[model samples]
Target: MNELYKVDTQDPVGEVWLLSDFQNMRTELCEGERCIYPNDLTKTLFHKDLPRFPLLVKYICANDWLSVQVHPDDELAKSLEGDPWGKNECWYFLQKGRIAAGITRQEKPLEDLRNGDLRILTPERGDLACLQAGTVHSLGPGSKVIEIQQASDMTYRIYDWGRGRELHLDKARVATKAAASAIVIEEMRKFDWKYFSIELTKKVEGSGIVITLSEVPELHVLIDDREEFSEEALLVRPGSFWSELL
Candidate 1:
């Protein structure tokens, strides 16, 4: 059986004061921490239903900026952190205005961060980035995205602007140490369809990106080969709702 999970919305920096409103607009499935799926699907599937597909999809609407964060790699997470799996994510920009992504002060050395001179990279609309675990990144304000990733909720926040709250700097620093060794600060190459059965295309608009997904029915079981279906096309608009296939 197929199940859908909604993500739990959180405000780490308190910048997203209206998270409740934005949470209603977008949908997400953050496993272990804030999963909306009411079943033990995350645990049962990979074990009992080996042949069944276990993919989690989400529509993220960032009303306010998120903290600068990074996820741990599988080996490092498993060996050092004792996590069974790690995170690998891809982002499709739906609406983009004053957006920033990627690592900016990668080669700047730890001294830059100590001296408070670390620079961060921001992304624009029509940009697609594949986040390999351990990549330090964050999204700027006025951005919406369709995020597809491994079903794990192991995010390590590095920095959050001081907004009348204190962050867990000790834990965050530990996570940063594990991830700092692998941070890459370059333009991420677009996802290639040759690697996966699906293809995504994007067109630039005023402050948004019109995204299109192309797939061959033979390659995807959920997508029908007979006729064109609107449900098959997942469309995400900024400050709006997210659509998914059941």
Candidate 2:
């Protein structure tokens, strides 16, 4: 799927980290030489105590099937794993097909291990799904997506389609619960929360003027949906950035 993400994987494309302080293999552009963490801008944008970027931005392409997995919340992660953060994410569908997220109701022990009343959906382009921490979910085939989540890699893979990966059933059973949410098929006003927030703008006129008021970093994406959806992203620091359309 070179069109969306520049990858050539036949299997489910696990992750493509665009910008990260702690997880990227690609080095940052430093002193006219390409080195790790090219941007010292993380500290300038976010909390001084945070070692790296608090958010992990990625694009995932699931050509085939993905494993049913759950991520722990912050408290559990800190207590059990001693990790700093947990993953809470939102997905934007590029080329959508099927997806299984959460369940009809939270079942004790999650019987038969992955075949409980799972909510299946077929969402088209421009659809959004907000998956909070502890949500059990899976990305089905033919789905190309952009995901924004907390910068943590502790995914408890619960069920793996008999692919023979290790399963964390005990943790999954405890992490997951019956959660209700609707697929947002229309234009979003904004997704505001304690962790992160997002706003999708359509036909964004000529340019964008972003004014940053607080310490938190702001991610601005200008998507041109005229012919094909071509996007340019700018990480707005603690000040203002006036973008010019080329």
Q: Which candidate comes out best when scored by TM-score?
A: 2
> Tens-digit lDDT track for model 2 on 122-198?
77766777787887888888886677677787888877888898888787767675584335544344555566655
Native-structure RMSD, model 2? 8.5
Candidate 2 CA-lDDT value = 0.58
Total residue pair clashes for candidate 1: 5
Compared with the true structure, the alpha-carbon lDDT of candidate 1 equals: 0.41
RMSD to native for every prediction? 11.6, 8.5
TM-score of model number 2: 0.71
**Candidate 2 off by > 4 Å:** 2-14, 23-39, 105-108, 180-185, 201-246
The top-ranked prediction according to lDDT is 2
Candidate 1: list runs displaced more than 4 Å: 1-54, 106-125, 163-198, 201-227, 231-246
lDDT of 2 at 96: 57
Tens digit of per-residue lDDT, candidate 1, span 1-246 = 011123344532222111111223322335358544312332232223221122334555565667666676656666666655456666655545333344445565322232133334344554555666765556556665556555455676555665544444444444453333222223333343211212332322222112233321111111112233343333222211011111
